[model samples]
Target: MDDLDLPTAAPATIEEFRDRLTEITDGLPRRLRQCADHIAANIDRIAVSTVAELAAGADVPPSAVMRFCQILGYSGFSEMQKLFREAYAPGFPDYSTRLKNLKDGGAGSPSALLAEFIEAGRLSLEALAKSADETALAQAVSVLAGADMVHVIGLRRAFPVATYLAYVFEKMSVPAMLHDGVGKLDRRHALRAGDAVLAITFAPYSEETIALAQDARDRGLPVVALTDRPTSPL
Candidate 1:
């Protein structure tokens, strides 16, 4: 049988690599998902085992193992292994443990933590106020108010936000669809020009959710994107 028929292999491509990483870390918290992506992208430069080995070590499945390799643009697990073997090195300052170091200086005190959180919120509000155009918001709200169908899509960390938006829209007597999964999406129904989409995403955005947004936009739906960063691809 050819290599394509092999039980323990996967396609090599950047898309594949990203998909695999996402699948392997599907249910993880946002922080853990970021950590997984960071590790997968740098796997070539880090001392790691085979795709299977690494997946097992990372407590993920073999498919997720090969998917991680594919996301990095390798042909398959073998090619990823070769690159990893050639460039493998390791170093770190135990960054997670360093959070404990802050407590030594009273940085972990409740008052200090509260101050940091408040500052973060202030910075976020300031950035949003500076970057978001009032005209765009008004236009989007107008489109939403008049659309025959409004779809809200979000994944992982952003899913809760989408749900809340859907609930609010429902209370306002708007026909809103909240797509948190494949089963929730009714793509068979034709989405026309008057339809509106609200897509919420954050850094390390979910590929599926992004694709859904693109598909809606292609179908002539007006898309209003809510993202943590202005430069986010939606």
Candidate 2:
């Protein structure tokens, strides 16, 4: 297998981390592959897993876990663990413990479920606001406005955002094209240099979207992507 070079920066989100991990699974050594499989299958446990503990669960040695972390551009297992913890677990009792608490709720009511959902949404929005880069958002809007035509490409988890962007652009009388890539048809031939592409994708990224984004860049299109991390192929 060829050596994989990970981005220098930590992944911006857990979904982006998974996308990169999926890319390397087929090329990993057998022990590392086991580690990958275990991590993917048991995301809920990853936040709390130690190098030794996770290695034991995956039936690999601690050294293999370290090697896996190094291949992903981390100093060691702990650095990578920190990113996952921040993304999904957020430093508290583990998810299973929380679920157990919910089941054993001593002071519960019908409205408690509603409160739980509302609180979850509030926390999610706060996290998003905290993580947002104002400069980046400004640059994105500027670039989109400057393009001759804006092409939006996203599939699976990102499709709704892509469609909404195209819809909004059309409403404003902007020249916009949404590439749903139905049946994986050939669409790159239609793109030109003056166009801008707004691509959105996360974990298990749509291969078709990545390929099209690459095509746009190769043809000199300015691609403004909304992705979980810099490593997103788009």
On the 0 to 100 scale, the lDDT of residue 21 in model 2 is: 80
Local accuracy of candidate 2 as per-residue lDDT tens digits, 71-142: 877888888888877765453555455556777873277698777656656665665675576777999999
Q: Which ten residues in a row have the lowest lDDT in candidate 1?
A: 87-96
All candidates: TM-score: 0.48, 0.61
lDDT of 1 by residue, 5-82 (tens): 322445333334334554555454444354365555443323344555566556677676565445444565678555
In model 2, the runs with Cα more than 4 Å from the true position are 1-47, 52-60, 64-111
The most accurate candidate by TM-score is: 2
All models: lDDT? 0.62, 0.78
